[model samples]
Target: MTVLKNCRLLPSLTEGYDQPTGDIIIEGKHIQRICPPGTAPTDSGTTIDVKGATVLPGFFDLHAHLMFANQDYNASVLRSQNEYMLDSMEYARVYLKHGYTTIRDCGNDFYVGVSIKNAIERGIIQGARIITSGKIISPIAKGNKSFGTLYEEVDRPEDMMRVCRNEVVHGVDFIKYMITGAVLNESGEPGEMVTTPAEIQAIVEAADSLHTYVAAHCHGTEGIKQAIIHGVRTIEHASYLDDECIELLVKHGCRSSLVPTLSIAFSLFNHFFEGTILPEFMEKAKDACEHVIEGMKMADAAGITIGWGTDFDRENFEKYVGLEFTSRAKTGLPNEAILRQATINSAKIVGLEEKLGTVKCGKYADLAVVDGKPDEDLTVMKKLPLYVLKEGVLVAGTALQQEKSYE
Candidate 1:
């Protein structure tokens, strides 16, 4: 058993943030009890005094590509599969050190994600809990082939089911379908729709049969609408969402939540605006940045569930993850709401809400303790977590070593 004494709990749907000082008791991997400070049972156990640090549920990134090492798309294609897998282990450590306890990798090449996840589960690697889509399914095109192993190409709608089943056979947690082009694809434009609604529906049906969900990589308004109508579980990078698309999302019960990777757009814009990035990529970045902010504002107003994602590669992971908070703040969301987007909302996006989101009793004891109050100063997260606990074990930061108790 482990006891975390004297910590300030973040507000959740069930409990107020300022309710009172408390202690969290952990047995095995789950939280055993939460009670007022000094009221916990005094028994033989490992106790860590948090010294009144502010504690929040561990952060989650719903949309990520763990194998990509940098921003150069072409370079990613040429890199060897072994190299990508090796680099990803380091990337996982960086995320955990920064307070993200869980991540859903949107896509990867050569089934590296599956291997990495299995390694972590077996205790061979110390990293964030990973949920991955083995590889992305897209239409056969010159542009898609340029990505090499990153995408699995299918020419017909019927092929969608076959490829989805293949991904499940390889042990994927979900399916990823390309409904529209990407910002980094020079031969393809982001606003152009690629996968038809029928194709999307086929993929959804295949995933449903396997008891999993599909996440669509959509940017154009039409593609976004089609994905919602076809029951895609999450729409990644909905940069061109308009009024019609917003209405369809809300009317569909918002079951298909939105994970707006505003950090990628802003990151590209900063580089392109300053002439550091290529002009072609810069033009696409400018358009994406402008449209995504508008879409996010509309979605927020319509009560759509919005989650957080950075779409960052290993080289930029630590630098960019926290910026999602500021990007959403620019959309007029309060600090507390933005924090929840990274925590609770993201948990729901990945279908782990009941076990992972809040720091409540009976949930997994995944948490980050910060030195400052995040409710007031959102930037405090830019600093690494003061302490991190995954499954009630001290994975990072400072904690006292267990000492033998003697009477």
Candidate 2:
């Protein structure tokens, strides 16, 4: 047993430990008890003072591309079985450092996610719990090529089903389908809806049979409706959503994982004059930003469930969690609501509601130790966690003198 002493247990947005001080007792991989401070459960074998830090459930990234980064360069490609193992080890660690103990790897190279999940379960990697969707199944098009093309195409109902079912048979936790074209299409216009509703229906049927879920990559209203109507659990980017589409989403009890890929837009704007970006690219970026901004406002007004997701990494990877969280916090909503979006709501999106997202008895011991009170200032989320615990294991320690850094 392990005891996290003197911590403020923030269970969720509307729920928290009533007592001012308490100890989080961990037995094996689950939280066994939450007792008052100074009262260590008799079976406790390890003790660590949280120093009055706020202890909350570990964050979850509902939308993530594990292998898209490698598409830019083959130096770090993990398509090979051996390379996949080595690369996943590092990927898992980076995700854990950000206090995300659970992640849904939407897409990856060479089924890296499948391999990584296996390794993590077998005690090979030290990182977050992974829910990966093998390679994204897209339409057959130029964008489908891995290297020269920016997208991976997989059109045609037969092929889409074949590949999607193959992923399921391969033991993917979930299935991802690209219903619409991406924002970065070389033509500058959002790619046209590729798969038909019938096609999506096929994959959805397959996922349903396996008792899993489908996460659709949709930026257009048509594709969004198709995904929702076909029973996809979540929509990746509802940038083109309209009132009708929003209502459909609400009606079907589906949620959206807004990547707010502001970094992508910012990147385009930053490099507009470099001639490396196309005029159409700039236009698409502008359209995405405007549409997403308006869409978010509408969704918020409609009380639609919104989960925070930033498709940012490396060069523009804003490591400061607060910086990312602030984007939603400033949306004229309460900070606690934003926190819940990041924690509880996100967990619900990925089908992990029962296991994680909130601090409670019998849940995985994944948690984050933050410096300041998040209730007062959501920006403190930008502060690097004081300590991070994954499944009852202390993976990081507070370095008081170190400055909080963004990824």
Candidate 3:
């Protein structure tokens, strides 16, 4: 057992915690007790004097491409699987350092995320608890093909199902389907919807039988509505969700993961604002941002569940939660609501609520400790966690004395 005394806990939910300044006793991998400060037992296995730090549940990033970012950025021209894995390892380490104990890897290249998830589970490296959606299913020249790599070509439902089953067999937690075009396509414009409703239904059915959720990468209004009707668990990059699409999502219980990667937007819009970005890219970027803001406002007003996911990093590697929080706030979502999106709500979206995402007893002992209350000043949310605890064992910072290093 481990006892963390003098902590102000922010329990993911907006409701106030039972113990604002109390003690949390963790036994094995679960929180065993939360009591008034002085009531904690001193004879436990480990005792931490938090000095009244704010302890919130570890954050969760619902949509991310794990091995794509570093591969894209670090690769001078081209990269092999072996080279990609090397770069992915660095991302995994940084992911843990950034206070994301758990993440849903939306898509990846070279099947690296599948291997990384295994490596972490087998204690090969220190990384986040990853739920993966291996290669995305989309039409030719549509999905991962845009990256010039990581493409998986499928032409039939059987082919799609076979690949989906193969991904599950390879230990994927979910399947990704690119139902629409991307904003950054090189074809002078984001093309039309690529995957048909029948194809989407096939992918959904395949995942359903395997008991995994499907995350659809879509941008167009019709594509978004189709993905929702077909029952995708979460919609990523909803850059153009019209009222009809929003209503369908709500009517069908669809959730959205808003990836407001303003950094990328700013990158694409650099020319318009500072006359640096290419003029053509500026219009595309402006349209994407405008649609994204409109979609976010619609989602927020409709009371649909939403979470943070940024298609920011190369290889869709991990990112700091603080930056994600700040970027999401620009989408018109309140900072406090965004916090829940990062934690409990994100957890629920990815089907990991039972294991991670909150400070409740019986949940994983994933904790993020900061110097101040995140509930107040969300800007300081990513201040290097003073300490990180996973499964009741301190894993970073001063907590390292009790941590088991994977290195």
Best prediction by lDDT:
1
Write the residue-wise lDDT of candidate 3 on 1-407 in tens digits.
Answer: 78888988764441224646788889898887778898899874768788888887887766666664432332422667777677666666666666778777777776778888889889878887777777766678632444545556676776767878888887878888777766555443442577788888888888888888788877777877777887887877777878897778767755544443444554454442344223556677778776777777788788877776755564323333466665566766666677777788777776677877778767788988777766777777656677788777676754455554322
Candidate 2: what lDDT?
Answer: 0.68
CA displacement after TM-score superposition, residue 13 of candidate 3 (Å): 3.4
- The local distance difference test score of each candidate is 0.81, 0.68, 0.69
TM-score of each: 0.92, 0.85, 0.86
Q: Lowest-scoring 10 consecutive residues by lDDT in candidate 2?
A: 398-407
TM-score: model 2 vs. ground truth = 0.85
Best-to-worst order by TM-score is 1, 3, 2
- Runs in model 3 deviating more than 4 A are 11-17, 69-77, 142-149, 188-191, 255-283, 314-321, 398-407
Q: Which predicted model would earn the best TM-score?
A: 1
lDDT by residue (43-143, candidate 2, tens digit) is 53877777798887888777765544332344433255565556556767666766778877877756778887888888876777888887777766554
